[model samples]
Target: MHISEGVLSGPVLLSGGALAAAGTAIGLKKLDYDRIARAGLLSAAFFVASLIHVPIGPSSVHLILSGIVGLMLGWGAFPAIVVALLLQGILFQFGGLTTLGVNTMIMAAPAVICFYLFGRLVHGRRAVALPAAFACGFVSILLGAVVAGAALMFTEENFLEVTLLIVSAHIPVMVIEGMITVFCVAFFRRVQPDLLPGARVADMAAPQERNEA
Candidate 1:
């Protein structure tokens, strides 16, 4: 979801910009060179997935695979999201430059939250991992909607209806994203388990290998 330019108040925009800047810094700090490729892949996925949008007032409905991005990249989701959003703003003008910080926070905050909440659970057995994956996706969208709604409301009370509509509109998307996350998690678990959170093959090497490296 993205909040169009000029919809948010100056204070709201400043706050969002500050938070996004901090998150981006932490994401860059935590991001290692080895995970750069995965981050790029997910950033591209996010950029493409959100390209098809159904505009609803100032916001829009789209795939927003932020949950999957977060599950794969952890705090790195911040920088990855910023990159995609920046490109979208620059190339497509889908979201304007003035609103980039708010949009990035809207998507990336829930992503980072989901990463911390469900990172470990995804490594569990199928029975547990599947549900966690679903929840991760579902909750990420839900929180995003709330954040977007709150931003609008804080900007102007007249936006209450739009806020409600935005949340209502994304209900189906939340479930769809949940199922998509489940599928991705399952597929990755089989073919590239190392891609999932806590499953990095390099990190799991034996103590001798670690010392040698």
Candidate 2:
């Protein structure tokens, strides 16, 4: 969900900007060269998935697919999300420049959180991994909605209704994303387990032999 530029107060905007900067810095530091393409691909997916959205007051509702991003990129979600959001703002004007930081924080924060929460579970048996995958998607949306709501609330107390509406509107998306995550995770586990979080760089490349040596 993208929060409109003028909707947030100066202090709120500054705070969001600072948090985003810190997250992006950490994300960049932790990002592996081997995974750059993966991050770019996920960012593109996020950008496309959110292109079709329904505006609700200052925010919007759409498919974030953030769970998959987090599962695949972990801390790298910050930089990936920031890039997608920046492109959306510059190209389509879906979100404005001034609000970029807040919007990025709103979406990426939950993604990073989900990676920590459910990343390992996805590596477990089917019974555990499936539910964990679903939760990763479902909870990321829920948390994102809450974060969006909080930003609005902090901006102005009168936006309570809009905040409620934003959260309520995203309920269906939460379930849809959860199922999408489960399917994606299942597919990746079969064909490309190395793409998931915690996959070693050695595993990503050909451990048998590498030009890096």
Please tell me which predicted candidate would have the highest lDDT against the true structure: 1
lDDT of each: 0.88, 0.87
lDDT of 1 by residue, 107-212 (tens): 9999999999998899899999999999998999999999999999999999999999999988988987898899989998889887766786445675669789
Clashing pairs in 2: none
lDDT of 1 at 64: 88
TM-score of each: 0.88, 0.87
Candidate 1 regions off by >4 Å? 52-61, 201-213
Residue range with the least summed lDDT across 10 consecutive positions in model 2: 199-208
User: lDDT at 206 for candidate 2?
Assistant: 64
lDDT: worst 10-residue window of model 1: 199-208
